[model samples]
Target: MKNYWYRFKHYPFYQHKWFRISLASLLLSVFFFLITISNVYTETYSIERFTEAKETIRSPLSIENEKETERERRAAIQSVEDRYEISTEITQERVGYVNELFEAIDKIDEEENDSGQSGDDGNTVSDKEKAQDLQQMISPEISDALQREDLIQLITASPNHRSLGKELLTTSLYDVMNDGVTTENMQTGIDNIKEKLQYSSLDASLKEVLYLISEFAVVENSFYDAEKTVEAQKHASSNVEPVMIRAGEIIVTEGQTITNEIYEELKLVGLLSDDRNVYPLVGLILLILLIGAMISYEMNNYAAKRELDAGKIASIILISVLMVAVMKVTSLFTGSVNQLFFIVPAATGAMLLKILLDERLALVLSMMYAILASLIFNSEIPGSLNMEAGIFILFSQLAGIAFLVNLKDRMAILKAGIGITLVHILTVLLFLFLSFEKYSMADVFTYMGFGAVAAFLSTVLTIGLLPFFETGLGILSDTKLLTLSNPNHPLLRKILIEAPGTYHHSVMVANLSESACEAIGANGLLARVAAYYHDLGKTEKAHYFIENQMGITNPHDMLQPEQSAGIIINHPYAGGKLLKKHKLPKEIIHITEQHHGTSLLKYFYFKAKEQNKYVKEADYRYPGPLPKTQEGAIVCICDSVEAAVRSLKEPTKEKIAEIVSSIINDKLMDGQLNDSPLTFKELEKIRQAVCEALNGIFHSRIQYPTNQEVKEAN
Candidate 1:
């Protein structure tokens, strides 16, 4: 619970109300679409059933019940008459049942006829034999008619009469209303029955027997009609409630209403719902999931490829949110945004990735940007999916990212922007043929125009926004560092003028540091550039340092041990502050601050200790947060090694190696090398590089000596 609360407070998305709002809105939209789709299908089917019910209620049998309700006093007399009429109704019921049997036989014949199985084959049965087989299924009711083939022939001869006979079976109940058997007829029938009748009424059991016969006849007729209707519409495939279509069947087109065939396909794929509007929402959600996965993959790749600062990472997330908002707002006005909305994020992220991180990460970020663009373009309420424009923008970004893969200069980024325009035009025309199937040159041109505008906008925005992040956020992008590291820059030229020895030393150190860094898998360019600025503080009092003093009198000769120690320790800290003021990379600032990690000012420490018993060894130490990065540690080791090796009057490969190794070992033993990732193996490699560098720096030379050296040699 505590961890959850901490995340809620600290995590950016959890803390941001807008993220929550967007998430909730997505879920609500899906739910609303589900309800709408379900209701559409449900209401349509409900209306269908209601119409059927009204038709059923309009039958003639329904009117008979109304008439029967109107005569209550005559009901008793009518009941006696009704029995005689009901007795006659039983005979009609028998006839209706027999008619149903013939209707079933006729339907089977019709089916066989359509299928080309109506006794066309030599071995197949004739229509006479098929009638015999069907008569067995509808026995007793159809038996009497079957005994006379002449009666079947008569029924078959009148084709309309056969159909009319089937309709009469179901409509026999209508005779109750249409014929209207009168009370006069009923009374005359009952009086004639009295002559033979001793009992006042017929047996109750017998009346129930007659009613059962009538009920069976009605049910048999309904079944026969339902079966015939199903058989007639067999080609319509209406028998089964859920229909199935075979593969390769065309279900619907762009202008067609979703047909039963299409609906069945959707059902087969489990895409159709009790509600219908969910398809668009489903498409949107799928895009969201895809975009999210791509973003995560890119983020992971960035973390793997380069070391990202927390502040820079936050800036990236901020840009993503801003781009998402732009997509939403622009799509509302027109379909202009489309997948190109992702280009804004991609272009900005690519510039940052290339400058602040690496070029490979920029390509990954561009693809991720395309995914986000698709989601933004396809969003039901806010998406702007211009199919043609979206395809153009996607390839445009791909071309842009591909063109600028290893770009280091502003001109390269600009050239890539123009290249994106051409790529966009070609891709739009290609996708027109591939995706849309029809190509219109004018439409393609219009899409290309939009794409070019989008790419140009991205370039302009990238250029404008890059500096703000570089300066305000303290990020040292490649472009920013390149600009600052120019040799003609005022600070570098000033260093060259006032402290030529230190300037020369910095240049040599830059080469040594860069090579060593690359050897150990560290940032080589950063290490090299940092080496140049690490000793800028020596410019404040150039003559005080021995290298810059040269033939001039050294001021250190007059200074006390404590004063000289203070001067030595203060330079690195001063350099760090100066670089910070100029807004250099923190990595560079760290190299300056940590280059001289609390090592003794040996000359001053020994002198002070001999002269004054109270002069502590601690006071002679340089202020330090020891090297915290591999590059910083490399600079630290390189700094000491350079000065120690240069101090040798005559150098050898063995002496150079020993001196470099001793300096590195001393720092390691003193715990100054604890933070950086360099291991014993890397340190050995560095020792070798230093030895190789020293051999080249002080190569073997013949003694072409001064006058004293020449006289001694002769």
Candidate 2:
């Protein structure tokens, strides 16, 4: 039952990370939904027109007020004055009549003179007869308009006076009709020509003739143009700007009676409609689900790699919740004017994720956080996003992630913080300069100060939170591994003092393990740290292990074969227990425990079999749950190879390579690496890396002549 329970507890299905990861995603989604609900939720007012004693109300959305826009358009169309066009045809017809009348009088006078015969008695013609002839020669319309006496006077006048009168009448006629004459002003047009003729240099009789003729030339020329008037009205309507009830615009004032227009505006902006709330809530849910999907996707990749554990899951949830909470809280104080969101430590969560978890996860969640900030800082207005805040946060997050390099170095976060600060300042400047609104020097300094503070705070938070994950939760980060690998660590120092030979051996194993792990794309730091502490069990009985029994008789030589085998097999577990008690990270402890599988203690088991008729082989083997990770598998292979190669009296490159291959083959045959998921290609790479490292350590040294021999030769 106990063995069954052990297998049950370690079952892959039981420990599968998908369930916990899904829960984390759901928790974050719910948190996002709850925090951002108010931003998208709408509250309808129960106020009526002419009602007083209400708080100041603002628009919850931006929409064109269609009714108001239509009203304004109508007003613009009404404001356009009617347009009129003058007709040139009317002016030309009137002027032609005056010319024809004068030319007919001249032709009649010329005909009478040239004939020198008239009245059938061959005598000079009477003026009346001449007028009668002139009248006949003139156009019917012109003759009908004039009396015969007026024509007789014009025919009796001297040709030069008639010429002058003709000139005067035509000039006044053209001048009066060229300007448009409406029906109301037609009489005025005729009177204007009559007045000009009255003041002319002609005699009274000629002036009278000229006056009568001028009246015919003046008529209405201006006309109302319908197409032109309609076009002008349409242009005026098109130019009218749409009346919009902008988001956050004031709709009604406190203690002021609500007017019909104000109430309609409130309804238009969705401040007085409950149905408007539903759509935004639905949109928010979709956004939250998308964020959840991104998180689940990243977590699935980690699980596929067998790297996602409960601590990492918890870390993702904790950091994301904390970041969103901080942004939401900061948003409470932010406004369209002050925008205190600039002071939020937006990069803190990214820095922590990059340090304690995966960089890709950090980046993905950063985008989610930025989008959340945009919504949260939108002043609870539907369809409004604080894009400046979102853009600034995104730039800050990218800068933080991009600058975080050399994960082993403690100063990486600081360098990243500096980069984030610069990016934040530039982003703030980008918004400021690109904006149409003016900002003062004080505003510039204030925002820049906010950016710097945010960077400093992010750095401080990351540094502060790292130990919480590393020490409190036992989740090993690269920085934490670096710390443990230091010789000055208490556990490391203890190993060095109590087991000097074992310490040297562990150090060599660590070097080889790191190289091999790196070659195969495994966690090199984890492999190296695991190697450093794998033989920590030896400190309990340093002389028992061959490496620690320096300059002494072998303790195994004095012990019974089974007893010796038992002692050797217990060390890996003993070291595991010590690591657990020290509260070291689980990765280091796991690697330490699994580095040696339940492979047989061949020398001791064989010796015991020789002495007895039957010796149980199982009793001489180490108790192991075999290495289940690449780092553990690499450490296991390199540990044996390092020790075996070091024992060679004349270690050569060929010998080191052969030893590496043999140990790997032994591990493979015993199925020690069955669970590590190593491909044949990766195994070959690891073999090459271990052989190269070992050969470098065991290379031939140069031999120099002694000091005495050199002096004698000189």
Best by TM-score: 2
lDDT of 2 by residue, 615-673 (tens): 89888887888988999999898889878998899998888888889999999999899
Colliding residue pairs in candidate 1: 37-275, 37-276, 37-277, 38-274, 38-275
After TM-score superposition, the amount by which residue 390's alpha carbon in candidate 1 deviates from its true location, in angstroms, is: 7.3
Clashes of 1: 5
What are the Cα lDDT values of the candidates? 0.60, 0.85
lDDT of 1 by residue, 263-374 (tens): 5444433333343344544555565555555555555565544445555555555555544455556544443324343233235445555656556655665565555455
Q: What lDDT is obtained when candidate 1 is compared to the true structure?
A: 0.60
User: CA shift at 379, candidate 2, in angstroms?
Assistant: 4.3
The clash count of every prediction, one per candidate, is 5, 0
Best by lDDT: 2
Score candidate 2 by lDDT.
0.85
